[model samples]
Target: MVARGRVLVIEEVPSQETFALWDGVRAEGWDVTAAPLAATVDAVRRAAPDVVVLNLHGAGDADRRALYLQAAGRLALTRTPRRPPILLVGDAGPDEKPLGVADVIRGPYSARHVAQRIGSLSRLSTMQQEMMRRVETAGQYGVVPPELEPSNQFHEPKVLVVGAGIRYFAIERTLARRATLVGAFTVDTALDYLERQAFDCVVLNMRVQEAAEFTARLRRNVDHFALPVVVLADPREVDEVDAAYAAGADDVVFHSGESAIFAERVATVLKEHRLRESLKAAYARSRDRATNDALTGLFARGFLLDHLSRMVEAAAHGGRLSIVGFRIANIDEVNRQHGYAAGDHLIRQVGTVIGRLVRGEDLAARPGGGRFVIVLPDTHVDDAAGVAARLGAVLRATRFALPGASEPVSAEVVSAVADRIDGDDAESLVARVTL
Candidate 1:
């Protein structure tokens, strides 16, 4: 189990309330601090909180958010290349105004909610810092060697709670069986020590209201963080998980419904980048086989439709578009005289000629046994026709010499107008040009 780290609470509440919340966090094995919300910036810089919780009930909630954004933007520790998780505690408006903390809590925070939020935000911050450290230590190559990996690799994903009273001890054993557990404190020395450590993810199990407020405070800090965050929400409103992400929660899982998914979900996110690389390689190979012809270097007819459709979605405004179709005129005669190999050689040459004459965006593909289509994006019909005419000239000029050939082979190029398409869809545009 990983250790719980320091947590700083900046609340506009009574000292006793702060103490109570402070006690709950401490019971969870955390070094907790209850400072005035106004002094949050200095305290955080001085003490450097793993997680900072703010109360909108404090003076100038709005200003705090703005100042925090600016202050956090410059803080070298918080602004490290990797980002931390933030908690905001507040109500949802058209915009969840920044309370200057990473996470926010809605008004009427509960002790349980505050405790959970603290736990989650702290771990997430730790994870964010870990990723940054990893990326930095690897330098330009960006690979974490085995030595580096084992030296200070983060613990397996799990929630770590600070303070002890909140049943943090029991959960520690439970989490350790399947996940890594962590602990820390808000006291200056303890906070300093934990700052050097790392974790995989964070979960804040605060009361619904405190979770909201804590989430609001956490928003800025985690805005740039990539670590996964799960808010401990009541099963009743589990559907509000979507709202959580919209406000900056990486993830939200109800303890009642999601006990099974916690460990698995954490592992998936931590490994997401590697999985993406694997999937991308597989997809590229499959796509190449489907789109490219083996014998001739031209794309297949089916490939044209698929690629054109995709390109249309990303086409530039007022870009030119053109399409050309050409017939082999007398492919059978040449096949009969020479052989299949010679025929293939001629096709390859024609594909090469078309490829050389066109731009990178242009598509040259064999539509059928003896037909070809050239799709030219960002081109006018007249311009495409002119290019086709030039290509026809190239075909006539090039003597496609066969192994035993005495003369050169030529092709008849036919082109039609498809200038200035009204619709953006690929099929309709191709139809207009083909017709």
Candidate 2:
């Protein structure tokens, strides 16, 4: 089994009580290192402890508290990219708060209290390291893309934790106890993960360095904006809580030391997210059924005509628009020779070819049986004629294999072109090309 985690104990001068606390922490299965307060900077570099326990009971005056805080700041500066959580064992006067510290316990406490705090912090650290290891390993090999399916209800919720701090990883551990965690080391990595995977909720710790910036960044990204974010706020820092809301946090989870609360908050957000996704998927399916043809997978005739009206209106306002119309002359012959299924195969093949030739913004539709139309935006009459000519040539040159036939059938295509005129409506423009 792996060691639980490492702890660094810092003291101005080692006392009997401090040694006793560390002894208890060690018995709990942690790698404990005791160093004088003056040598903390060096000892942190060597041991790389996950939790730093600061012993300040020896300080008898306010000046000593100031010095201890200064020393804590120096230790923070020594670690780059990621700083360990600091657990202070000292008494704080009113209006006294140490920056970047995780927790504080007053003097004259038992060794068990210190051990409890260290255990919690160490467990969180181990969770972070383990989750990050899984992420980096996946990045090396790669993950298969999720299947495209209509989601009607909640699946297993994949939660993303967006920092390496104590509460952030603790939330990861909490959620992992109930669900699997999709971990990320920074906001950028989280954004990348969101693009590559489907997640139900996100938990962000505002205490991490540059966390506020990352939250804003996540909000600005279009792909990640709708993702539900649960901000873990420090109950004492009112400004941070407000900032999290201003940055578009969907929910806030205050640090209350209860893991169950964290897990429940994530579950609630996940339910909401699943509902939103279900509505979106249902809307898309309904829209596609209304607008698309059942056989050819192209836009339906009525929808295409309505869209052509909009294109014509835009062309009247100084934009260019062209239409290419084509009809397969041998479609009836093929149907009679083989069957109706062969005719459908021909139409689908023609639709696929047109789809391949058109630009992403161009629209392809079948206004009637064997008659196809392509609306090309920002195009002149010359270009439209060129597209029509290309369609005719391709249809004649390519032989399509019909179902249960020994030989392939060559299609004969008759094509026409139309450009938007000064006095033209959707019906007139479409008639000029089709008739």
Candidate 3:
């Protein structure tokens, strides 16, 4: 496993305890080096560590101020684009804050405690950089990331367990508290299930020969791109954790650990994944609203025309395409006599009827004022006419129940059907049907 970040330790006189602490950080897969306090700025300029660890042991106020000034100088060096996060270690409480550090660790700190603080500060810095990058990208692209609302409502999250082992069973039992766990003995089976249905997260076992490949492929898949993956490894195989992360695993858990820990890790990953999925779903809904009519819940005029254009090209290659233009025959009179509400009620009822009649492959849209259009791909003129006639007859005979109406209001539908001509375009086809 390769180290992720470099850490530079600045200590005027290195003690055994300080060296031990540096060794512990190295064990955690961080590139760490020691430098004398006098050479701190020059070392920082050369090494360009992701973070600087300053030992303020037995230092006076003047010394602390001078060290902070040196650290600040490194920020202006050409090699360092931004100031690296600094951790000040001394016998101090929260009240004794350092001038040039992101965080402070009071004395009597264990190696693990120091490493954990460094890791957290590093991750926070990474997140901040990522956010700034997203903001810049959004400015360039003219589209901002959607802000999603936090939801406390818990639905049973669906989890897919890949590969066969005792860990799978343990995960199944543990995750069942909040998730519905389904097992896939092989990667192919997992993909088949994924294609057929959506899974909120995948618990992948590192022991599976293809687990790494599976994670890569899963991330590449469009449907599962945002889906969270948690890789599980046996304690003996802890070295595989780096591979799991490289393969796009969101979190890795050792199967030998407590079942509760496994469950909690899974839950945390799921919470974040669900937040992202909510944002994406919201963005999709906003896009749909932009391209669709609010009144009829159908494609708007511009979008409908764009579809027509593509279908026309396909029709030229011997594909069948049909368009049906329909309107409420007495919509004007209904609006004049009963009011806009009655007219709107009539149109909505007609849309409902058309929606029920059209096949899943067909598109029904309220393209403009008091008019609707249905695009039937791979449909002949006769088939389109039959559909239009059925819709027209049903709409004319069915009495639409309107709000505050004495009786159900009866209405008539007038429709025209047009098939793609040899030289037809989107405009011509739509014009023919409406004319």
Candidate 4:
């Protein structure tokens, strides 16, 4: 299996608690490393972690501050193009908030929650690095990338509160200062609100089962798949917390009635969500007609080659690049049974499914006919194969309607995965998978 990302834990004294935390994070599919505070600088340079976790559990105020600064400074000095974010795994005073820290997990926290935060930070770091590389490649083709101008206008985040009683009031009061709050007493009402207006985050102030069900429902919708969902649950119900994460809750906060802490956690999740939205917009704006397939709105064949070439060159420096190639095996059959127009319609629907399934950073291209390729940067061949499987499953599940067909037709998608070899170029890399 492909690891989520690499994480380095910097702790002065190792304890059973810390060891358990490492085991849990590792179980979550992350590569975790433990190092002492004295070796912080060298450990980071040597490990080149995607995120750094600082254990400040038993440290005093001064000690905590010093450790945080030292870790952040050493990470800044590291010569890697992608600098890791610091995740403080203990109490952080109000005054201890620093500029490079991704988040601070205070009070009694679960290992699963910490792992989720690490995964978020790691993905953000990777997206930033990918953006930089894509910009350079676009420039090479004389295609000017979109300028991400700093906006002077500030909009308050809109938050939806789904629950009832005192918790709803507490959430309203907590977010009133920082956001605009809308309350929904029932699941149907919450779904209605979601369809009508946009929200930065959804706070489920209900029972664990209800919250999990609502979360799963939101995830099924394409528009709301990436929207952040925070579940407020009773600390005593440990199994419910696991179920929440399993149902796709972004963060599960045990209800402690601490309004300030809840507000801060919600803010942290919102910040990451907005940052991802900005990056996605930049990716969309960076594309032009010359680079995109007109019918499918995917990357064109020529642009795919150019981008793949740059990715292959970068792989020499140390990184993984894999391609998932797909072909609609029955396109010609569909054309013969129906007409050329029906074939085109089927192709368009397939493209739409592929576009929805891929990550923002993954480049999906329609290289013409029934062939499609998805370039997965920093992805291993095994992971690439998993992606291909998902695409195939979804395509096979979908039934395309034709102009003169008695019944809806299902797609037969054939897929192959190829990782870049030592002597592979853009043409050879794509051919290995597609051909």
* Candidate topping lDDT: 4
In angstroms, give how far residue 355 of model 1 lies from its true place. 1.4
TM-score of every model versus the real structure: 0.32, 0.35, 0.39, 0.85
What order do candidates take by lDDT, descending?
Answer: 4, 3, 2, 1
Q: Please report how far candidate 2 places residue 430 from its true position, in Å.
A: 1.5
Q: Say which prediction, candidate 1 or candidate 3, comes out ahead on TM-score.
A: 3
When summed lDDT is taken over every stretch of 10 residues in candidate 2, the lowest stretch is 137-146
How well does candidate 2 match the true structure, expressed as C-alpha RMSD?
A: 24.4
Q: What tens digits encode model 4's per-residue C-alpha lDDT throughout 1-435? A: 456567898876667887887898898778899887778778887887778988886345785658666766666666765578888877677435565676777765777878888877776676677778778777777888886642112888889999887878878888899999999998889999999998989999988888888887776665676679999888876566777876668888877867777888898778767766676567677778877888888889998998889888876555678899999999999999998888888888898878766766788899899889999887767667766765676678678897888899988899999988889999998898784
Scored by lDDT, model 1 comes in at 0.51
Clash total of candidate 3: 0
lDDT by residue for model 1 over 315-432, one digit each (tens)?
A: 4332345677766666667788888777777777776666545433356677666566777653446546655665655565566776446777765445555543456576776666
The whole-model C-alpha lDDT of candidate 2 against the native structure comes to 0.65
Task: Tell me the lDDT of model 4 at 289.
Answer: 81
In model 2, what are the clashing residue pairs, if there are any?
none
Residue pairs in steric clash, candidate 4?
Answer: none
- Cα displacement (angstroms), candidate 2, residue 366, comes to 0.4
